[model samples]
Target: MSTKTKVPKQPLSEQLSVGIPDAGMFEDIPKIRRVAGDSAGPRMKGKVVIVTGANSLQGIGRASAHQYAHNGAKAVFICDYSDNHLETHKRELNSLYPDVDIHPRQFDASNEAAVKAVCEEAIQKYGRLDVYFANAGIATGAVFTDIDSAEFMTMMRVNVLSVFLGAKYAAKAMLLTSPSKPHPSGSIIGTASVAGLRSNAGSTPYSASKAAVVSLMQTISYQLAGTGIRANAICPGVIETGMTSLMYEAARARGTEKKIGQLNPLKRGAVADEVARVALFLGSEESSYVNGQAWAVCGGLSAGHPFVPGRLS
Candidate 1:
């Protein structure tokens, strides 16, 4: 025989109440503010980095540049094909982090000569190039029938060819400066997309271009083997950048902004800074062993088809 303590029961209403809040509750979720990394210390100290596709004030390239500066990168060359916002971006970042040298370059990333020149510029100016983020690319949604051959070629030129140039030239620069560092080392990061991993995220050509980008990183990582340099691709899901501004605006106009990223487990679209954080991680020494991989920053969307919590479909 065992003595048992009396069990207390909750009220029926309390027992039956659902723990999950309604989706409406998400409307008031706070925006993610950009700040230095958790420690707010010099994490990328003395590193020199290049970030392409950085003209947009609200883009991952600009955000990554800021992240590098915030973490004490000695130099950050922010390049873009468009010169329109490059100066403005430079000013804004300079105001926040005066110590970080921010160079604004205007050149088409798809042009092999321009890419090579920028990489050489970094090596010439800084005597080292630790990271090169090949982040410049376009977004499109035209379906297969609507897209003509020229359109497909344009997409490939801007997206696939650019990353190829980035890897080829950035690797050369890194190799040139490897002896100056402790080891033959560098990091090359490309901006792929969840669309590249599967269908439904982008138009056919766009998805193909991104898939090529992912494959490029994987191939180059091994090609650069034993050199200590790492190559990786970041596959972002639904991020709120200039590329997706129209989608966000339309959603807001239709009063459906809260539903922006419902397909993902997190149920909210991410900002550029969120993606930038991952770029910073790949660029830092903490990820020295992280190589030849495509990191999905998709808020668990890539884990599988999102399902309702506590239930199976």
Candidate 2:
């Protein structure tokens, strides 16, 4: 007599069945934040926001500007050194959001006088600035050994000095302007980078400059602790923007696309919008209690492998 082993049957949900009231159910997901009763719209209604380096369409600054405007900000001040591009961005934003208020200004953020003048002009126009996003920066791809002294200085001045000037003026402006009766506070955000947290192989100057920005944000946050002006930094990693496009192209030219992407645990880069969302969060009242923090928007890349040897396991 031969005996066969018994086979257990799978559950009804796991088995393919016809017209059996589908196993998976769908449900409405809750919104992250609500601005009104039973409504999920415009968390930052009526707030005034300022975003620097907003001229380029493929930049973090422009992304943040659009996010703020979409989230119900009353007015957005878009500042950049490119007058024509800034005007174009202004036109584009106005066309997209007919009722939104966008103020475009051309000023070199690295220039102390220029930053101060821009702040004064914005205050004159908007009456007060509730949030300031200092998102302007420049990076060079040269290695430390190959970089010239002038290049290093230029990178520092543009990347580091620009943030300093922007924060300095924005903080001063916020201090003078009294907040609304209920919301007695303001926010300031700076753009740092993963390069600031850890050293990049070939971008020493860029890393150093961003590290300085992190320090600046921390210092400003401490100085304004009791003044109701919060300061923070957004450190992005491998974001797919104009800046990262250049890096990606360079990597491709060097035949290292796979290697570069493999450097991050996510196995992919992030879009400018991803980083912009974080900036918007920090700039909005949603993060009223978050201050002096360097929020990493790098898609877990910064949290992954601290060191990777080129030819070792």
Candidate 3:
């Protein structure tokens, strides 16, 4: 059985009423002792990966890129529509994982040509494309009355269309077997949200876009069945990422930080690494049998609404 590493207690002022998986709390590496017939290396060894929406320092895409490189991915292409943080992120990742090839690109993920080009680039350079994480998405809090058609369309284009393009192209790339890749095997991951599963977590357009993502993965997974490729989605709850930084900041300003995720059983908002770890798992061989599923990494919030313990009434 695996054991978790406990963190030392913190002072009251700095104490959190919630908990997160700390540095040593979870094991990301394969077991120290390898089993016979195992790959005999790190979780992502020799894999070529692509992650979209990776510019934000506190975003899941960035964190996932780091996790992939750390886990022995041969190359990780990190991309974002915005270029402001791309170079900086590349530098940081390169510094940390000198052996892993880290490439940063600036492009709109919703653009079919761009998405196709990226997949082709990975194939040309690495001879195989192992994983594609379609994590680029936009969110809004506009109420129904304030919603505009243009804005709503833009949301779908960025969030839903992007994932569609990613899956379409990535699957094509993964199917192309090369000398390095003896089989048609790969993983395609999309970032959905709990908002997609139900209401109250996002605005109309944002939620609709994410819902499309969830459905897209479900259908795509079946389409790729028996191709040695897998398609899946990650529906994250409240996380302290660049997209949700405003909400977190507001709660902190009101000195209600401890109540950030009070509705969830865990009672805490997650960091990017927490969600990124899930992406890493889907991208690796560890999840070889997992396909066509929407995995909710929402601190059990999606299990059901929180209720008073030992008080049925």
Task: In model 3, state the lDDT of residue 183.
Answer: 62
List ranges where model 1 is wrong by over 4 Å: 1-40, 178-182, 307-313
Q: Rate the local accuracy (lDDT) of all candidates.
A: 0.86, 0.77, 0.87
lDDT per residue for candidate 2 within 162-212, as digits (tens), equals 888888888777756443522235788989998898766228898998899
| Runs with alpha carbons beyond 4 Å of true place in candidate 3 | 1-40, 307-313
Candidate 2: deviation at residue 291, Å?
0.7
Q: List the residue pairs that clash in candidate 3.
A: none
The residue-by-residue lDDT of candidate 3 on 153-196, one tens digit each, is 99999999999999999998998877777667789999999999
Model 1 TM-score on a 0 to 1 scale: 0.84
Candidate ordering by lDDT (highest first)? 3, 1, 2
Candidate 1 lDDT trough over 10 residues, lowest sum: 10-19
Tens digits of per-residue lDDT, candidate 1, 1-313, equal 8775443331221112323233343467954432223444677888899999999878999899999999999999999998799899889889999998999999999999899999999988888888999999997888789988999999999998999999988887776634456344678999999989978888999999999999999988877766667899999999999999999999999999989888898899999999999999999876767888889999888889765667764
lDDT of 2 at 49: 82
Instruction: Give the lDDT of residue 15 in candidate 1.
Output: 11
Best by TM-score: 3
